[model samples]
Target: MGVEGGLKCVKILLFLFNFIFWLCGLALIIVGILVQVSLHNTFMINDAAASGVPIVIIAVGVVIFFIAFFGCCGAWKENYCMITMFAILLSLIIIVEIGAAIAGYFFRNKLSAIVHDSLTEMITNYKNTTAEFRDSVDNLQKRLKCCGMNSSADWKGFASDGNTVPDSCCLNVSSNCGKGAMTDPTKIHQEGCRNALETLLKNNILWVIVAALVIASLQVMGIVFACMLMRGIRSGYEVM
Candidate 1:
């Protein structure tokens, strides 16, 4: 009788566990689906390009949720059919997680290396261009000093010359020149770089969506397994 009671307790615990697992699975699935939809409609691939790791993590969570749900259901039902099904599902989830983890780890490093390389190249190009511009500006400053400020007599020639003048000199030469000459070239480059980086990162949205879907599937399977397990356990108890 004691042994029977112990078994009954175990069965009850198993049923509860299975139910909990099912709920967890369902929640995960819903979350995953929402994430996927958001990515599809709102996020671009570049948004994910900067951090593929998070997407992979979400995917793994989904798979695990499903596995837990199925396992719970199998245990609760005491149905060999469910057990076998759950085992297969769990095994697949485990395998996929392992593969994704490995791939994600390597992919992250590769992306980092690529971004670093691209940044280095961009910086180098920017520096070279900036240096050239600085040299031109310096030369123009020297020319301005040598030529002296243009009066009305020299205004036409000064305006017609293709020489690039500094803002200070431009103001001295013409009020209109100074008004528009204050544009910062460096700021322009910085803005362009920022936009490019953002676009690049948005490229990983598809992968993230895929991961969310997998998690949702897992959650549903978990819930089904849990209910089956509970029914089986109750039946067993009644028979005993």
Candidate 2:
């Protein structure tokens, strides 16, 4: 094929790649919002804190969207300046993402310990905490079918209204079973919230790593296309 035809093909491929890249960014933004909403009312007793994670994710998504826009424009116009800019930005993003993925790998291993500590703290402060916080913990227990941070023994230390455990810790959702179940270990949840939360965070981190790698691969392709298209544009200029 001629140079013009090859250039056309490259531009089309670049446009399609950027369009999909932009969609990935949009998906990331939605995921970030959902995560933030899910964890909004929940309390975190960790020293590192969990509050900023969703915000950072949202910001990364926004930045990706803008970078993809630059890529799309560069390909469409076959502009050397825009393509060079896009390539530079994409390279920087890939480097940052690699670092993030590495950090996530180590973070995943430590998540269980951190969550264990956080849950223990939450259990300690449960009664003194607000109703919303209390409800959040209750919901977690109910959904995970677990009790306290480690065992029902964790609730033994809590003395409030003569109840050993919350209603959510019962075998059934019956209010009558709640107090009585505390005495009968068989009637209460056998597992603990710490284990449940740890499992959940591990799964989340895996998905996050997978997603980052996928996006990074796409970004690499974009960088290649941007450079090739820039070269083609310069060649065409010389031919003219």
Which regions of candidate 2 deviate over 4 angstroms? 35-46, 49-55, 160-163, 183-186, 237-240
Clashes of 2: 0
Clashing pairs for predicted structure model 2, backbone only: none
1-240, model 1: which lDDT tens digit per residue?
654565555545555654655565455455445544433332222334334445545555666566556665556556556655665665565466556545544654455444445433333342245655444332332333211122112112233343322333332443344332323332111022223332333344334445445544554554454444445455555313
Model 1, stretches more than 4 Å misplaced?
26-43, 46-76, 113-240
lDDT of each: 0.43, 0.74
Q: What is the TM-score of each predicted model, taking all chains together?
A: 0.38, 0.89
- For residues 1-240, write the lDDT of model 2, one tens digit per residue: 477777788888888999988998887677666655544445343445343455556666788899899889878877789889888987987886666567667777777777777788778788898887788888888878888887776787666544478777887867656674566666888567887777776676666566667888988988887777888888764211
**Full-model lDDT, candidate 1:** 0.43
